[model samples]
Target: MKKTLLAAAALAFTAGLAHAGDTVRMGTEGKYPPYNFINDKGQVDGFERELGDKLCAMESLTCTWTTNDWDSIIPNLLSGNYDTIMAGMSITDERKKTIDFTQAYYPPAFSAYLGKDAGANIKGVVAAQVGTIQADYVAKSGATLLEFPTMDDTIAAVKNGEADAVFADKDALKPFSKAEGGDFVWAGQEVQLGEGIGVGLRKSDTALKDKLNDGIGKMKADGSLNVLLKKWFGDETPTF
Candidate 1:
């Protein structure tokens, strides 16, 4: 993993979707393990949870978590269903058109292809979460794309013989690949894409954006962010 801080985006999104609430609502897809998920306790839990909590504390903001399906996560944010999107959402110019993003907390990592056969052809059927960059890639790469409403379904497609493989953030898919034993392996070379993940806020909420950025800057300076990244993903993922 390359150790670096992704630059802050010089942009704003949804200037009309301003938020005013006592509690910061952090929306997530609670299925991306190591990043965000519902633990055995049934509460929102994972690396982002810990990091979001820390960031909220830094800004002295009260925060609450909401789990939503991945496909509608961004639209929900725009609709004021939540105050911010803290899922493992990568910062991209396309997404920047819909919502503003903070400087990346996690640097961009590789997009991995996982499958039952190590020799699966890249042109074979590929499964990816709907509305993801991975899905878009497969659609344009000549591979038949089988879009799922969630990440779990994408993996299920590969497991159920519906897809030759699943494509997603390498680190986001690490736990699944490992848990699949030898049934699934990294089928092809990894591809890195987009800016890293960040906290997504409405464009009108620059105040909230600055506070979160300030918190992230403090964590980067004190090495706390690095510690959390290492804790969740080991030394394999890039850190601040």
Candidate 2:
């Protein structure tokens, strides 16, 4: 879900290896809701938090969570600030070249345009979170792309008429579209981008990657992943 402009810089930093029984640090953006966000008590709380905790428990690994800005989430992991990225990040070929990913925990989600004008699709000024796949798509679609550091900023741009529309995950935009006294509406045909969301790790952390994959596989086999998806995203969301 990010651009690779800092890939080389990230690659330059090596992960400080962690051994078994050590507390594996999980990094997240703590902004994207349903996936991750800071709760009323100012602690990490959301679907990813619950899922990550369960995964760690099942794997017999001690884990701790930390929050980072979305744009630098991957770089910090490579720099040894965190062992894994549990932010709502999509797995993409462009990203895979920079970091290793466990099997997807969330399936590919559709990107939608949120605005007051229903006819607006890819045209006019479009707002997107900086370095995200939605931003990349808008940049390539010949639309005027306004990049913001956070998802909230993108929505603000649309609300304030700074942009014609905001392109983001449909799930991310759903609340605004249905918000009481708000006029937000879907402005485009939904488009699917990237593979899916997953746990991002440094390429050298193969053991950690394998362990996460194994746990994810069990979750899928037991239908627990589906339960979590529906709990956060509603029954309409797809399952494995």
Candidate 3:
């Protein structure tokens, strides 16, 4: 009886160790500006990168970042290449089908941009980035759709008259428009497309999910999240 009790205690201790030291590999499309872009220094620098660093510190876990194309991020997560995703991904009902989301850390909304010479009559018809809620809205709202791999390409399509307008997140459009010599205009009111952005994790890892949620909540309560947001948006709070 004594031997059995000792062995049971040893097994429980091993299990606890396994849970405590687990590493989380996070994936993101490092090309989206103001969120997960690769800077000129050849390093990832953006709101999501900063936020992920904070979460890792709070959770007392080792975190790693890997870059992939935006379209492939979800599939890579499902295949277990990464434990979580922080690619400025919005929490939507459609995405919730495959992976679980942590508490939202950033707002999610869509804005439209038009070229200087584009007609206002083409205002309501525009293309949005593929695999986004903006694309879904365009499909349902009778807008013509032209998909692109990056926001820069989408904006260029409008500027060159290949497409009349482009729809994407406000954070993305704001910087692009300012840098491009004021060639684009924000059309209509910005659309609140979904809930805030969250970390995507595999459905089987409920323990890690809970850990991340707690860490994010702590970041918010301690003002770390706001600090990162201001670094990206400069006095504007991200809208969900």
Best by the lDDT measure: 2
| Model 3 lDDT on a 0 to 1 scale | 0.76
Positional deviation of 230 in candidate 2, in angstroms? 0.2
Clashing residue pairs in candidate 2 are: none
TM-score for all models, in order of appearance: 0.89, 0.91, 0.85
Query: What's model 3's TM-score?
Result: 0.85
After superposition, the stretches of candidate 3 with alpha carbons farther than 4 Å from their true spots are 1-20, 117-125, 178-182
lDDT of 2 by residue, 116-193 (tens): 768765588999999899999999999999999999999899888899999999887787784534568888789999
- Model 1: lDDT of residue 37: 91
Lowest summed lDDT over 10 consecutive residues: which window, candidate 2? 11-20
Summarize candidate 3's per-residue lDDT along 184-233 as a digit string, tens digits.
Answer: 76655567778888998777678888988998888788877777788887
- For all candidates, what are the clash counts? 0, 0, 2
Better of 1 and 2 by TM-score: 2
For model 1, which pairs clash? Answer: none
TM-score winner between 2 and 3, please give it: 2
TM-score, candidate 2, is 0.91
lDDT, candidate 1, 1-240, per-residue tens: 123222122212322333344468889989898899999999999999999999998888888899999888887887677888888898999999988999999998789899887787668899999888888888998999999988889888999999999999988787777564445788888888889889998877888899999999999999999999999998867887
